[model samples]
Target chain A: MASKRSNFNRRKSFDAVRAVVNDVRVLVARGLTKSYGDVQALRGADLDVAPGQITALLGRNGAGKTTMISIIAGLLQPDSGSVELGGIDVFSNLDAAAKLTGIAPQETGVYGVLTVRENLEFFANLAGVGRTERASAAAEVADQLGLTELLDRRAGKLSGGEQRRLHTGCALVHRPQLLMLDEPTVGADVATRAQLIESVRSMANEGAAVIYTTHYLNEVEALDADNVIIDAGQVLARGTREELVEEHRLSGLEFTLDAPLDAAEVERLGATNTEGNTYRTTDDRPIGALIADLGSQSEGLLGIESLRPDLETVFLAVTGDRLDEGAS
Target chain B: MDAIRAIVGVQLRIIRRDPWFLVIMFGMPLVIMPLFVDTIGLSLQAEGYGDASGAEQVVPGQVVMFGFMLAGSVGFSVYREHGWNTWDRLRASAAPAPSLLAGFAIPWILIHLLYQVTLLVTGALLVGLRLKGSIIAEFLVLLSYSCCLIAFVLLLTAVFRTINQVNAIVNLGAMVFGGLGGAFVPVDGLPKIAQYLSPFTPSFWAMEGHRAVFLEDGGIADVLPSVGVLLGATVVLAGLAVTRFRVDETKEFFG
Candidate 1:
């Protein structure tokens, strides 16, 4: 726990440097900490999401990603620390902060009995949109999220993906300056995930800062945004995907042999025997040379697989574990 | 104003969609009042009481009961939001707190007024009980009483965590208070302690105010004291609700 606190302090130092360089941050948190009885959910974590940029917050389950978002959204109070959005203190001035932030929480709070249009209208109106404009705004948001056909359908009756789409649309309808989505794409199909990501991208393009939290490394990769990898209630690494991958030394190359090779050749290649005909190798060098060397000697090579360093590898290297473990 | 209207619109929409609310609002009083009048007939005949019409007494009592139910329904509806966790969605919105509270209260007030009118009209047609005072005058009294009741329910909702618990408390409060405050029977028939306690119940003032209108003996000026008590209760309860309510996201309801 002490080590975790120091790591979080280190991440805070990194954010301090970014804050100096970036002046138009849409959301900023400094030394934010929260505890539930003996359970520390967030420990001295710091984060800054710049205007029009998507920041992916990746963590294992119970890594305080949701707690952080909840605090930033003014739904929870941190035990000690400050949070600012659009130059206004979110905790002290909720009315001002409310105008600048919108959140799509992990649990879908969409009213089950209301129709899609009704749900949209309720949120839109709450954002202070006038009645004359609410219907048109609801229609536009529904159409944008591909919820037009489902407008009259009850929200509880929609598929999981459709409900997620509606939840996204509800958050976006207000056009908040900072949007926080907590696991927005969980349980979504491939197509729905792409659709949700596309909507998020469009919102970011419209100059709203986007902070997304997900256990899916593929979402982190798909978002292709600045990354913050949190573990044990503290951010362990913060950088762009390539920068973190480089920092964590996650580059690797692997080759597969079609038939069982002699023990001598496998040992010479520095490959760990995985099982059966499979072998795994992690090397800093380019994989092309290994593939060429294997091709010349073995004609029965059925397939060769190589993985480029990405956020998942960086997360694994930094945390000493896979990103998807224990993620529901 | 916009926030208030928006919230009110949502509440009305919900009330429209809920069949159970509709039955309670419109159908229950219609069924219960006639039965009450008949039961009174049995007792009055057995005891050889005076020749006054039981329907005349029973119908007004049902109107007040309808008003009580209308106001208390807010607790159940708002409690549903707590159950489903949509209350936080509203609180976290950009709307002002007063607007949110007003939006919640307006639908109950309006529906209760509607039910009051239904009881009046149905009572006159089926049971021959005349509305003795001006329609507007009677409505104003009912409206004041309904506002006070709505405020009390809102206060209850802010403190309670579950709709079922709220429902049990609210329905039980309505029944106990309704009986003591003369909604189901005459306050004079109650024990002395209950009679003294009736003044504290908004239903007591409401029943007296309504009875004054039904007897055609007083105008709004004459019932000002009852209206004053009802308004005072509304103010105190509303203030307490606002003070107790917090939109903390860390709390279990929001979390």
Candidate 2:
């Protein structure tokens, strides 16, 4: 845990320095620390997303992703940090930064009393979109999110997925330079998720720096985004899917027993307890070898599975915990 | 200015879409005015005015009383954004706190003025509430009271973190201020202590202004003190609300 944090600190420090030296990144957030009473939401986190790049903030719930995004979006103030969007300091000149940034929070927020078109136009107007252009902007965003048909429907009356689309649509209506979406697909259906992912990609291609936060590894993979692994309010790793997997590959058998094995038996199998009664072999080991080693205790075996090297494995290797378990 | 305008525009639209709350509240005061207008008229007659009809006391009293109750809706609108989960979205716009509050205050103040006017006209028709004073003076009093009450409720909204807290205070304030400020009866009929305490409530000043026009046949110059007091209170309350309000503050609505 200490080494992972140390490595992240080193890399983040370098990234922060690079961000200062060059203006290549559209959004740069450095050393953000925020605490809510006793709970620290963020701790010296650093992130930089350049134009036309989608960086996925991959973390479980309560992993500071929302807090970081909120700070970047200027919806929050950090204890100590600086956020610059399009060469303007976010906290210093919030209005200017706001004009260049668009954020969709983790929760779906739409003006339910208003029609979808009204919701979109209101947000656009609030974001400084011109009177003459707001209608076209709303219509364009609606088309992109497949919300055109439901534009006149009250947001409260729309289906959950439709409302979700409108919620995301309101963020992009003004065509901000940097877009931050915090778990936009959390409660969305498969079709909605696909549509959102496609829209995110399209936004990036249109030169909007995008920060996408989600717990779903599959979504990250589908976007093929540069992944930033965050846990316990710190950034542990930042790389692409293949890069992360190759850097921290794992191949082992994970076996769960009805009852936990004693330390002696655990040592005999050369396994480490992950959680509960589950034990995993640290080295690449076949199920047959583990079965042979379990011997008499094999009767107590409840489940066994092989671990493949993937983003999930990478997350486990870096954070020493399962993202899927934390997510659920 | 543009941000404030945008906020006002959307808020007015939202209110227009769902105006049942205001409609229901408008009916409440009109119903209560006639119930005790006659008894209050006799109380006024005994107190002196031989030609007094109860409409003078009952109409403005109901307006002031229910207007206090209705002012809470502005506070509710602020907390309702949290319930709708759009508070953060508004914050993301980076609109200054004053702009945001004004955005809300502007539409509700106009609506509140409309509410008072409609009730006054309707009550006058129902119970024959003759406007003896200048119409412009009556309008000024209505506008001042509207601004004053809206500012006070917004101050309460800024101070409280939950709609429940604001709701409790607003409900208690309506009854206490109304009962003390002679909303149910003429101030002369109330106990001396109640009358003394009446001046502290916004309802007291508003009722005083209404009576000036409704009973005394006062013109703009006659009601200037009441209007001045209400507008001054508006400034203080609005200043406090702006100081206390934190756009980033988390306000709970449902829970």
Candidate 3:
């Protein structure tokens, strides 16, 4: 416990120094740790997002993404941490930070009984937009999200995708300086996803710092966002996709056999059995050399494939787990 | 202030869209009030209300009884926000707890008063119910009762984890408080035990103030004590509600 306490103090000091150095960042969240009873949700997690940049926060279930977002949005108080939005401490001055920050939580939360326009304007109004500007703000958000035609209709009557769009639209209607969308495309349709991505890109282009959490790595690539991979409540790695891919790239040969190889044969090939009947080796040897080394065991070979280095491969390398396997 | 105003507007709009519950609440008592009039009139006469027509007892009785049930709607609106998954969005707006509670309290108080007034006016038209006292005094009674009941239910909203618990309590409260506090029968007619327990309920003070207007020809000055009890209770209940309310706590709306 003493060692753990020392490490926590070290992280806090490091975050304080980093906060001072990164003056241009729109959001600086540091040393964020939260726990629910005996279960620790976050442990000294630190993140920074600059203006006009999109940070795709990738994490599996129980990875503390929602908790972190909720803390930043001022919904849940963190056990220990500080979030600064546009240089203002979020929890200390939540009302002022609320005007500068907007968040779309993981759930679809649009008011079903209200018209789309009403839902949008209500959120805008709640965020402190002037009465005269709320109407125009709602219209602007609806037009951006392609909900102009359905503005007058009740939110419940719209399609699932439309409701999803409206949910996101409400968050951005206030034009917050820092926008956090927690899995915005979970149940969205193909078109809805595309539209949301486009809108998010535009928002970033207009100089809002965005933290988007998702299990879909392709969305990260599509948004061309900087990647932050969190697991077990810690941000393990964060960088551009290309940067992460290059830094953590894994190259290997994987082959499946009709039957499991004996321990002797596995050692001979210097390969590890990744799963049933599938063996992998991260050696730089050519496939020809590995196949020749297989010798008589080659007769049992079913297939051979080369692993390509990409975000998925990098994610697997960093977290030792598949992204799709953890996604709901 | 803006957050509170927006929440009030949204809450009122939501109610306007789904108004059948309030309509039924209004209609049910109107039906029951006439049924109990003749029976309760005899009791009021025996109690020495010289010109009592029973409308004097039954009309405000129904209002106070059903008014307890109607006040529960404020708590329901709060839980409904959870059902719709919009509670977090509202919390994320950074509105203080007092602002959120006030937003809900304001509209329900207005609706509660309107509901009671409409019933009293209908009684005046249907059963020749006349106010022997100042109309303004009666309005104060209605206003104080509305404030007190809404505050009480909001405290329940803060303390309860599910809408079902609140519903059960509110339903039981309407009946128990109404029976004990002379909403269904005059305090003089209730058994000795209930009459002793009657003053503990907000309905008792409300009924006391209403009896001053409808039965005793009393002025605002005469009903101030009853109003004081309700307004004082409102302050205590509302303060408790604010303290107990937790924006981060998840409340279940539907079973």
Candidate 4:
């Protein structure tokens, strides 16, 4: 249901460009509109992914990040839209599209009754891996996901992090061309999260297109992925971490005075009093120049810090909300 | 097809890895068989069988009763996948819905057949359960009953949303159908209405076929009626299971 009139439209042109760019662009979804009755889950979400790169989907809880991932992973259907996986229409030919993709959902779902090896090979076999290669494939995936030592162990007996690793391992066993991990590191400990992130990075290095959704902004920096900030079921902005910071970062000065300033002086300094003896100013004037303009009131300034750019800052600036809330 | 095979293999492995249930299924019937043999023997004599120890009746009776309960495990397996959080992973496989359900259904059907067959063999050793009728006909009856009840339970699993719902119906089905079909007593010894209702239960047809094979020394022709009924019920239940089963349906596992 996407109109095709604009090739240079600022807001939507990136999706259009990546849609036709190259076969390396493994996934493309346009005008994805899904609703659960009157409550919309995805209100026209557009996303594209290319090989050897990861795109981090950042959003608050219930902001359609999971909905977008679920749609591409084929667990949910959109009311109106088109999904192309490896240049094949995903909805029209889901079997083929499923062949090209793998998804480790936000929830850890391993067959607890089965051994780690069985769990891996079973998923690989379901993904159409050859019987001859299933064993090696399982072993390799196990090693990659730090599950080699626990191959013979029942998944139910493993630690939570180990189980989480196996849950992600099942998806990558077939080495799908396009991999989507929906907040794979949630609830994982430090070592487990590190191992999974490394494994994901290695998979991408081998040319798999990755879509990683996470609330932990630091993990996004680890992947060095393009950041797509979504809110209220719409794509608010998409750019590199630095690009997002440059574009959406709320440049301002936050300062604490030795004592409370009157509202008149607060207005004279071109600032708003935020809390006890704290003032914020979005004026583009330099801190030194503003302090000079402050004149004798500058002596009362206790601390002055520029609000440095970060993904969290960018997320807050673009969505007017924190990403960490309900995201993890 | 590969997806189905893989799922079946996984399901079979899961059962094999945790086989206490099947072991209990096999053992419980053997224990209950001898206890009911003398009582059901007297019931059988009242129905016209002379000098029968009733092991033939009790063996297949326990087999049918326990077999019905065992088939509920198929539904439990489906719900268990949901409990393990693997249902969505299975859905993500892109296999057709019927194939996915078949993945769980096929292995359990075979296990169910094995459950019944092993009980018959055990009856022969422990309680003198002799096969006086055609071996082929008895095997046919067993296979058809296994298929029928497994399909019926799979349909129930698809139609219901929670394990409690499925367990309630299956547990109730076992006792109600078993009693009405005379697994607890003899069908002929029951009152007129119960005798009439016996034909509607799979246990009735199974007991009819087993009795024909054990007491009347009947061959395939004598057992064809029961076999036809079970196979017919199988097709209908399987069709319903296929029609009602949705891979995306969220089945509650524990609650």
- Whose DockQ is greatest here? 2
Candidate 4 colliding pairs: none
TM-score of 1: 0.82
| Per-candidate TM-score, chain A | 0.78, 0.91, 0.87, 0.82
- How good is the docking of model 4, by CAPRI class? medium
* Two-chain complex of model 3, DockQ on C-alpha atoms against the true structure: 0.74
lDDT per residue (tens digit) for residues A1-328 in model 2 = 9976776776677567546634688988899999999999899999988888889998888889889999999888999989988889989999999999899997899999999999999999999999999999999999999988988999999989889889899899999889999888877899999999999999999988889988888888888798999988899998877667767887788889999899988888888899999998868777898898899889999999888989988898899888863352
Query: How far in Å is the alpha carbon of A136 misplaced in model 2?
Result: 0.5
lDDT of 2: 0.89
Higher-DockQ candidate among 3 and 4?
Answer: 3
Ranking by lDDT: 3, 2, 4, 1
Is model 3 an incorrect, acceptable, medium or high docking prediction?
Answer: medium
- Please, what is the whole-model Cα lDDT of each candidate in the order they appear? 0.77, 0.89, 0.91, 0.88
lDDT per residue for candidate 3 within A74-109, as digits (tens), equals: 888988989988889999999999998899999999
Against the native complex, each candidate's DockQ, computed on alpha carbons, is 0.39, 0.81, 0.74, 0.69
Q: Please estimate how well model 3 matches the true structure, expressed as its whole-model Cα lDDT.
A: 0.91
Recovered native contacts in candidate 1, as a fraction?
A: 0.51
Best by lDDT: 3
lDDT of 1 by residue, A139-219 (tens): 988888889999999998999899989988888788889998989888888888899988898888888899998887777
Q: For residue B34, give model 2's deviation from the true position in Å.
A: 2.3
lDDT of 3 by residue, B155-187 (tens): 999999999999999999999999999998889
What TM-score fits each model? 0.82, 0.94, 0.93, 0.90
lDDT of 4 by residue, A128-167 (tens): 9999999999999998987889999999999999999999
